[model samples]
Target: MIISQQLDTKTDHQVQAIPLDSIAQAQGTNIPFEVCVDHANFVRPNPQKHVNRLRSDNHYQGLSSQEILNLPPWKDDFFYFSYYAGLNGTGFMGFEAGLWSLSNSQSKSHDKCVDKFIENHRQDQRNPMTQLWIFNHKLKQIQWKNNKYIFILEYRGKGFQVINYRKTAWDLAQDQTVWFEFVDTKGNRLGGCTEGWTCPIRKK
Candidate 1:
């Protein structure tokens, strides 16, 4: 059961359950989460393509942090969200600083898990999703992560806005199987989710 669903920023939270067997097939093999991130990044390069840029050229090398900051290139909205290396941070290492769009922001629940996973790397038990993040769109919020924190930036949308996000964790793994549920802020189950899934938080 392979689960293939899009997490569009426009869609409200909804758990669209698909068969585990199907998800496995679509995923090809039951690859570790880290491997999945590497492969996805390799194939797609930048999932968040519209809002970010990648700078790997040598002309940008040896500039001090201040000089790098002062460059006109840094002012571009796309530049702000994208990642750059020291004229040497090519490939994966260079683009690790991901910029979040609505889709990734909406997945903050998962981000908490991701933050923990990244930290766990020091403990030698890594969570694999950290590498899969890309800066597809510019976010209005302030995104920052330090050694122990994953901060959700603030953003303004139509009439509603996001001020900040605190780390929250949900247990989706049970009895060797993972469980997922999604609901709007009002607790309404979104019906268009993939098939065979149930929204655990839905209003009855």
Candidate 2:
């Protein structure tokens, strides 16, 4: 999906469309869940108890590991929500268990919304939240001005982690198009596509 943001330029604010692919490419392999999980494990040996409590919660009972990993499309909301729990320092298993609970708790309409949002972006990835997890990690700052057309994002970090961006990033590269600006966290224009850029968006 193209993320449009209202950037504060030298003269004034300009609306820019940041293709999601560009952002993914900039952030190489800094996967949030992997990092968060490792941090949690090193900080606490018995992190499983929290995970167990999450599993016992109404949202996540009787789910297999595979089920959590391969959550249904309708459960996308829960999947993304679990990222925050991980961001708050939950381990990989803790995140998975929380996701399992959330997936079971959401209604049909919520799942339909998830499906529609993905289709609207023409995003082909079966699990969009995986990419979102990465996006959330690099997203240093973001805000929506008046509407969707006006957005601002301050991304930090490098290298592509999401495979879904391959085709789009390739198309941009082959055509030699400059879709967005690559800047530091301070909003300095480093260059266009010559370098790399990152964009983060909330699923609507």
Candidate 3:
């Protein structure tokens, strides 16, 4: 886009062209996350519209050690409580930092699974509602192989599943450190996830 300018040196030249980038740079537009690559956008593009209430374009690079540590807990995925990331060091952003997604964050995932299974189970001889999780977890690391340490996962929610989960899993300390690699449960990228799938942490 060109701007209109009035000049006396020429025969009434009314249009002037100026680079938008030049204007933008002159203004010293602040980059998001205080991160940049030599005044150039280093952040890899993503399909998601926003992260941390900011336009993704602001910061083109990855998260710094301090930045990752400061992520809000309420934003943590899972049914509600909290499931924060286990970030260490400056790393790539988004999936490039590893599958890094909480399938629960998808919101509709639970509904989709329950609805489909309920519809199918309604046809059974005995009336019952059923839903199953099939290898939904997509863990980037395998911690169970070495068997040097033990890892536990706990979930709290309604229904029979809660009973099982409670017996098998309970509350870990608040502000507990959990290493995770969120993945695309939508099947966009597969590590162990296909639609309706979740990544699992292999703990010994």
Give the winner by TM-score: 2
Candidate 2 lDDT tens digits, 1-204: 111112222221112223333222232222222111101101111235434543564555776544544433212211122122222332343343232222221212223333434463465443333222222223333222221111122332211111112222232345443233334456554333221222322332
User: Which lDDT tens digits does candidate 1 get at residues 110-131?
Assistant: 3443444344444532111222
C-alpha lDDT of candidate 2 relative to the true structure: 0.28
What TM-score quantifies how close candidate 3 is to the native fold?
0.18
My TM-score estimates for the predictions, one after another, are 0.22, 0.23, 0.18
Candidate 1 vs 3: which has more TM-score = 1
Q: What local lDDT score does residue 129 receive in model 2, on the 0 to 100 scale? A: 34
lDDT of 1 at 44: 18
- Which lDDT value does model 3 have at 153? 26
lDDT scores in order = 0.25, 0.28, 0.23
Q: Put down candidate 3 lDDT per residue, 81-125, tens digits, no spaces.
A: 121122221112222221233222221322333344445344542
